[model samples]
Target: MIMHDAPEQTVKYLSLLGQQFPNQQAVFTEIINLQAILNLPKGTEHFMSDVHGEYEAFLHILNNCSGVVREHVDEDFGDTLNEEEKDNLCTLIYYPHEKIALVHAAHQDSPTWYKRMLDQLITVARRLSSRYTRSKVRKAIPHDFAYIIDELLHTHPDENNYRVRYHERIIDSILETDSTEEFIYSLAELIKVLAVDHIHLVGDIFDRGGGAAKIMDRLLSCVHQRTDIQWGNHDILWMGAAAGDAACIVSVLRNNLRYNNYEILENDYGISLRGLVSFADRTYRGGERIDPLMKAIDVLLFKLEGQIIYRHPEFDMEDRLLLDKIDLEAGTVTIGDETHPLITSDFPTIDPEHPYELTPEEARIVQKLVDEFTGTDHLHSHIDFLYRHGSVYLVSNNNLLFHGCVPLNEDGTFASVNCEGTWRSGRDYLDFCDHIARRAWRDHDRDALDWMWYLWIGHRSPLSGRNVKTFERSFIEDKATWIEPMDPYFTLTHDPACCDMIMREFGVQPERGHIINGHTPVKTTSGEKPIRADGKLLVIDGGFCTAYHPKTGIAGYTLISSSRGMRLKAHEAFRTVTEAITHNADIRSETTQFAAAERRIMVADTDTGTKIREQIQDLRMLLDAYRTGLIKEH
Candidate 1:
């Protein structure tokens, strides 16, 4: 084989490509296919942040695509279907098996109802499928009923009475075969897949709520749509614990206990907390008082954090080592000029000489907890998925998605952080931390594990932009001492110039790019806006966690970017999935139009489109080489 004169790299790339498509005809066909794909409308992307283990709300949003399914229903059958029919149809699409059971219980004529519902589902599916190519739609169809779905979707009964008979015959055969349940399930799933092209979970998939494990299971089992998770501080805490970090294990347990989520550890992940309970009961035995036990655990956590700081002085978190400053006899902790009374001086596990040292009992309990965390197959699988699909930050489709701030100095410049004696700032700093976090699990590196602990509470960590203030919140009574100032990035993010710098640093076009972030909840009740920097940055964490609902006054915010443009939706609280299925209740959402494109966006204008364009170029070059007689057609 011969080739035209080209650069060495180009020739090498083309030679590799030729191995797959060796003939001119194959190259031409691929080029044509790519061209056709480039002409299709861009797929919809759904963005939600700070789920915080609210699995019902999260699952409901995912199922209905932040109310996109309802919008599609309204658009497709605005006058044909009334509100009640639309609500029932949407519920069927959301919880197919459950809704079907309810329908069977309620309806006297089951067959007639099934046929009517099937017809409605087909109509909705057809409307959703219109945006995608037939090949893509076929791939999304369940394998068991692939042929049947393809036949139904392609054949139009309205074309003629004969076509109507054809459609009726397929439904009758399914009923006769007793396959209606399976068919309904497959169709509902297909409708969900067709509605949203991709899901972006911005951060905080763990903590507060009790259903993180359930949510993880749902995401892991997703086959049709794609999902990417931006690791939040809460998520990283659990990931570090799963890697067997002692401090992280304590932090996770402390948080779970504080939220009254012991069942999540015991029942969900099979993590036994009986040893900790026994230890706590024996050490702070006083009429089942949780406050004393909580104080003891909080002190233990501070000491563990101090040990990490002591090990790495470069972390500059010595101010957080408050155990040494506590006078156990006086029952007080001295900070700066102020000495505050301690709530409880019941830290029996803490040693005065070696304040950060874990006592024998505490050490045993920690070891058992670590074992429980890392030994559980379900927890391991969940963390493995996080490592597999999650990143500290993501740049996709001209947008930056991250869980927290980019650490910045008071003077509005990127803060230089020391990582193992090397100073890094901006994107380089985040990349360094991400590398260590993965290595903590993959290589079982001790330094990496310590760094994971550092990322949890370090002053310079982007995940934790402010001091944790756990000790201040627990021991100190003064409200002034409880203040944990946010990083300057939080204030500077409101400035368009600062946002432009961040966008440029991340290699995204500043004019069109946006930074989508979470971690801090948006207090809508207090009249706080999620959109910042005049639309250049967006903080979409409207508090999906029920604990934060009091402050936020809303369930959450979801950003939907489609062919038309981007829209931000504020959702009210979801009562329960049972209420949704039985009562046909959906989350009441208020949507605001953020941006609308002058022209509809196509595949050629997207990130995926860029990659397809490159492939087309290579194919064209290959075609030219074959025609020029420089390369053999075979």
Candidate 2:
């Protein structure tokens, strides 16, 4: 080969790449490894939305990978294992430590049982790991069992009789050493790890249910799994509170109190409510039998909300400024043209002339709560994690994932939003909102912090698809006034053209890309479908919050996007973890696959493949540099 002179910049880049490869042999070997990986089947991507703090259900669904583990179990053992055996095996996989104890308690922890389960688990793990490279599989294995797992997974018993004896001896040694339980636990966790290559939380990992903090803790603990979150409106509220937004702090307090989810604030997050408890006790007593804390928080919430509306008139939320609409004398509030009787008229904290102004005590309490919210390290950590892994929307593997709608006009056009002095719409608007959220958290900008509150409830906020009827529901007796009108996007999204427009605006190919959303509970009881826009969009929020189980008629939804295509699983309510561990009860899921064809998608067809190809190209360039004598090999 003739040596060629290279450009200075090109030499610089190739020389840097040479540090990792160092030699032509290393470069060529890596090229072969990456090329082989590209031909393997693509890893499974699990998508879940609107967890709403239901930690038990979310945990179970995550562990089971929305029934994908069960599918594998049934597929691998349908001919051999009975129904009872399969169910037990799945439960074991989900909660290994607990299931093992239960088995031990039942006197079923015999060596025979250990060998059988190890054999079965090893087989399933091998099948699951086949899609991944040996190095990737080794990395997923627990440190203590890395050698054992790698050996068991690679050794095919059917390939040779000697391999069977080798695998059996390892299991027997584990059984003899009384390490069966620990080894099984490790394998079970490894299986769970390999079941889903990536996790996409479409949004709402907070509020409604009491386990928001628990849910955040769980996600934070997932170090190995690739996970991303799309910010949900409810999530934005908590993020705002963590950034010390008074309106958001008051709103969070009110919602938690109203839903009786105070434990999450007091216990899980260590946010003190003692001040509010005292304030409520002294200021909110009346003929109404509602909890005084609830009443107090509601009054405080409205006062803060009114202030925000007045401060940001561009928010177009004057309709929510109902504090001044109250007629104390008649115990009624005028909404639009109608006057509705008030449910409670005790307004010791409100002044008719300055109704949005907080009373001296109210001001003190609100400030203290804001201080507490921003001061909590746990809250900040969770909020920081949210900011780190989350955005307003994400485009991954030709799918658009967002917690809510792309705000739209009634005529099926993207709605324009004014952020500061500039107007943005569609994807631009969402990007602006996402930028503000980060500024609120990272820089603690006052305006950005306030924008966080707006994102939670502003009429045109893409995160909040509907006008929140909090005030009406709190004060007005007439249910008509409490009907929060959803944005036109909610209705217009049913049109394929509208979804295509959204996909195009986000720079995704409309023909193959999907808009994945959450926020609105799909009311299956009312004959509603989660799939809309001729399958261009999927709303996976099937009510993970137990409060919505009645309306949604299901536990929740988890979408599995694999090489085989997208499949939606509507899950039945997961019974308590205790029941699941004790009685082997699982959340039964109904799977619906919507694929145009059953083409086995390989790594070469995915975003990961695109990245690997780039790496290969760079390596090949380095190889060229070496052969051409432009760069010397190590």
Candidate 3:
């Protein structure tokens, strides 16, 4: 029989593949493994948005895996363990080292207590491990306890009577070796790791709640699991600041001062506010109701912002250049058809002819702040992680995740945005924004750094869906002038077809895909629902920061996509971490399941499954090559 020859590249690729598989036996083994993996249950995806520096809340939710850990405990011990016992077990998994100490204090280091806790924890771990391949579970275990954990999870006492004694002896050994605490800690970690397969942070991991750096530190430690951040406008402001944008740097400082997040800047990131403090003291007097530092930073921010606006006429934010419109003598600023009275007539730094130019003193202070923000290694490391693990948007498992709107016109059409001299809309515009944002970090040129500022507040910016009224709100006493109008996309998204069009534009099947949004808080207090567009879009930002809790009527919203289906959870405010660890105060959450009647989802339906199938095909090809003698194998 005549055999057909393969292309040169195909032959070379198969030859390289043979190096990994080596022989037909190895190829067959891998193919079988891949096939088995394809039939397993799909891993759960946990989606959160607008964490907004609520580090304690975010950390607790993360440790609990959005209550998946508790659910596991409830499932395994619902009938066996009482409510108090279950709650304690859940708390133990969340803070093992701390909870263990407390347990020792109350129970006097009882061996009976340690042994009971270990058995219960192992049961939960084993249940979670059943959903994953043995190899994958082993990889997630700590290196020091990998062998012990693997054996404990996989070896069932029911397999043989000998195995029963073996399991008991292992637990007894752990108790005798004074390693109960260590073993329990390892089990707790493994349960946490296995509960949630992937974490999707829709956006706004920085700003507001005063512990963004702490939140970043916690996220950085999760090397064992998958996590991705979709950049929010607030996150972009910090990114731009880290990239040396003067406007962005002061904007960050302004917010920190405004929200009283001075500790985050001065203590966490070690950025000195002394320069601004000294400058504010010398610049502003005591009569103003606003803090002197707030007034000082606002003036500096407006000047820097005006400079950027003057350079980029394309930004169409000429109206925001209000310093030029200020009449210092009258203490009023003309804004288009209306003239609003300034809250204060303190314009010591404004030169009538050059309203955007900073005075020599003002320039020196802001420059120092810019240098400090850019030079801080800790700040840079966190921002570097954001750039490494974040993006403009993410399409995972058919759902499109973005921090803000897909800018739309009033007629429910994708809005054309002029990005980098070219007009693009929808996905194209977002792609351009993403490209320029990366350039802002990579090149740090004048234009790119300026683009980062635009992404933070520009009306056309998809990341920032509303025209920010920062200047108007700060200076003008008129509440009417402080209304920041949202983009048409916010209104247009009320229509399901509009959301479907957005999904299709992003190359997702509208019927199955949902747009996960973050920038806007869903006002549940005022009878607003996060699920909108007939379930085509979900706004998961249920106010993670305290400021919006009154408006949103909930602490936060998290989405879970598991093998069963998707669900949205509204979590009540986390009282305090101390309360959680001591009193077992888990964030009381109400869950709303989406399409609960749908068929169970399996690994064969996932993105990872697609890649695995491709691998299986490649291995089959390598096996053929080995049999045909086309490639030699060891």
TM-score of each: 0.96, 0.97, 0.98
lDDT of all predictions: 0.88, 0.89, 0.90
For model 3, residues 1-634, the per-residue Cα lDDT tens digits are 1123878888889878877889989998999999999999999899999999998899999998888888889899878999999998999999999898877678756898889999999999999999999999999998878898888887765756787788888999999999889888899998999999999999998888899999898889998889999999999999999999999999998887778898989998889888788888888876787767888889899999999998999899988988889999999999998888898988787899998899999989888888898899999999999999999999988999999888888888888977768989989999998999999899999999999999999998989989999998888888888899999988888899888899999889997888999989999989999999889889999999999999999999999999999889999999987788789999989999885626778898988999999998888888878878888889
Residue 62, candidate 1: Cα error in Å is: 0.8
393 Cα displacement, candidate 1 (Å): 0.7
Q: Candidate 1 local accuracy as lDDT?
A: 0.88
lDDT of 1 by residue, 1-634 (tens): 2356677887777778888899988998888889999999999999988998899999999998999999998998889989999999999999998998887788743888888888889888988888888999999999999999888888775746787788889989988898988999999999999999998998889999988999999999887888899988898899999998989988988888889988779999999877777777778745423465576578678878888888889989888889999898997988878789876677676778989888888888888888888899999999999999999999999999998889988788999998899999999999998899999989767789888888877778888788778888877767888899888999989999999999999999998899999989999999999999999999999999998999999999999999999999999999999999999999989998977888999999999999999998888888877788766677
Off by over 4 Å in 1: 1-12, 157-164, 285-292, 628-634
Model 2, global lDDT: 0.89
lDDT of 3: 0.90
- Looking at model 1, residue 38 earns an lDDT score of 94
Instruction: State which candidate has the highest TM-score.
Output: 3
* TM accuracy, model 1: 0.96
TM-score of 2: 0.97
- The parts of candidate 3 lying over 4 Å away from their true place are 1-5, 158-160
